[model samples]
Target: MDLRVLEYFLMAAEEGSITHASELLHVSQPTVSRQLIELEKELGKTLFTRTHKNVSLTQEGLLFRETAREILALYQKAMRENTGAETLAGDIYLGMGETGSVVFLMEQIAVFRERHPGVHFHLISENADRICEDIEKGLLDVGFIMRKANPLTFEILEMGLRETWGLLVPEGHPLENATSVTGKQLRREKLILPENSFFQSELLRYLGAGAQERVGATYNLIYNAFPLAKASRELIVCLGYPGERQGGLIFIPFANGKDAYASLIWKKRPVQNPALAAFLEHIGHTVSE
Candidate 1:
């Protein structure tokens, strides 16, 4: 049906007379009456009973009135939300430090998609250190990294949030029974350390010089770490706790070392695009939870 006809029908229903509806709609009474007739024909039912003092809707007309109002309201809301109304609706570029963390990002991104279906997401993944650097270079709108960064250019949403880093032991390992493995316990087993010198250096600092020398450190990815850890009963791997893992690997807390949580980074500058900022905020809230 024509939108003009629907408007005419609504106005006539509201004003209780075609003459008033014509005045309100800036149309002739005959024009208003014609549109109402067209609307009634399209709907296959009479909408109103006209009297000299009042106009009353039929039961079907009353129900159709509610439906029309709801449809118009939803259409208007979509138009407002999709346009520049301080609501986020556009593309967002998000980078993840760890591939394992993508699962969490995907869940949050899914909600964002539902709320703003028009928006597009461009996602990338890399090492934690690289993510921080990208966040510094202004290439990424937001990022999640394993290490803490204090870059002046980018604002941190999740600083010092890495609440725990733990030892990753393959399932069925004996040390799984222990509450927390100490440096002394580490000395007795083969160890899988991070491939990055920065993480290795930090682990050494956390372990002290003497104990650090005994454990074997590898500059390999976590996927490799799983196999190496599983091959040897005594080989223990270190990783951020609650990290992504295959079914074979079991993560346990370490006696030493503070949290190895990933931090969130976004542009420090005033956000030019509300959509991107909203997405960044959503991601921040998700990580916090």
Candidate 2:
């Protein structure tokens, strides 16, 4: 429950040894061990599995690790923002999905940071669903998602960019030279597709009936799926970005594809941080111009 104890728990988890964690924390080994014991008691869960040699996280500890990290990050952010109230400076956390439209967002961030040098940016790359969740949780100040903004929950700014859905085929494959591929043609090949449920549904709709049978694997990020696609005959269904090329792979658009639009979204609440407010205003002016 204590922040210091959380730090000790994380250090022990990372080092796998109470001795090593105490050495790093500038405390005695017994102190680290005692704190961990108290932490486990407070939570009523055994967090670590102990051995004579080292310690490892139990299933509960593994889940708690993520919660601890989020707690620490949020605390640090609050401290920074509150302390820097007199200055237009603090961290602005942003989440984004993989999309070419992020180039426009980065441009705005560059201009904003130039005017407020003390302000910093932290960017997280994730799927739209995860990004939305983070924004809702106050872990992110803004999110660039590949979907329409939910007016009820978020204040939105249209990025005015659309991503083309396409196939990432291995070089020298039969479809490499094709200008565009259709759903019927795709049904003949095993395909690697995005793991996001929203996008998966859209893709399935685009591919028509019985197209799910052709799926070979799913990927959270397209780059990770590239090698899987190259090594085998599997085609990767992903968004095509401008001037982006992968070695040993060819990207061909889907015939009459449904393009995914990009939107900048934040929680529909009062903007308490001046840095975030200024950044949003900058984006509005830039987008309008």
Residue 189 displacement in candidate 2 (angstroms)? 0.8
What C-alpha lDDT values do all the predictions have? 0.66, 0.82
Question: Each model's TM-score?
Answer: 0.58, 0.71
The residue pairs in collision within model 2 are none
Residue 105, model 1, lDDT:
60
Which residue runs of candidate 1 sit more than 4 Å off their true CA positions? 1-89, 99-104, 159-163, 210-221, 232-236, 240-246, 283-289
Model 2 over residues 51-80: C-alpha lDDT tens digits? Answer: 997999897887676567557755666776
In angstroms, give how far residue 46 of model 1 lies from its true place.
71
Tell me the TM-score of model 2. 0.71
Instruction: Count residue pairs with overlapping backbones in model 1.
Output: 5
RMSD of each: 19.1, 5.5
Instruction: Give the range where candidate 1 is weakest over 10 consecutive residues by summed lDDT.
Output: 236-245
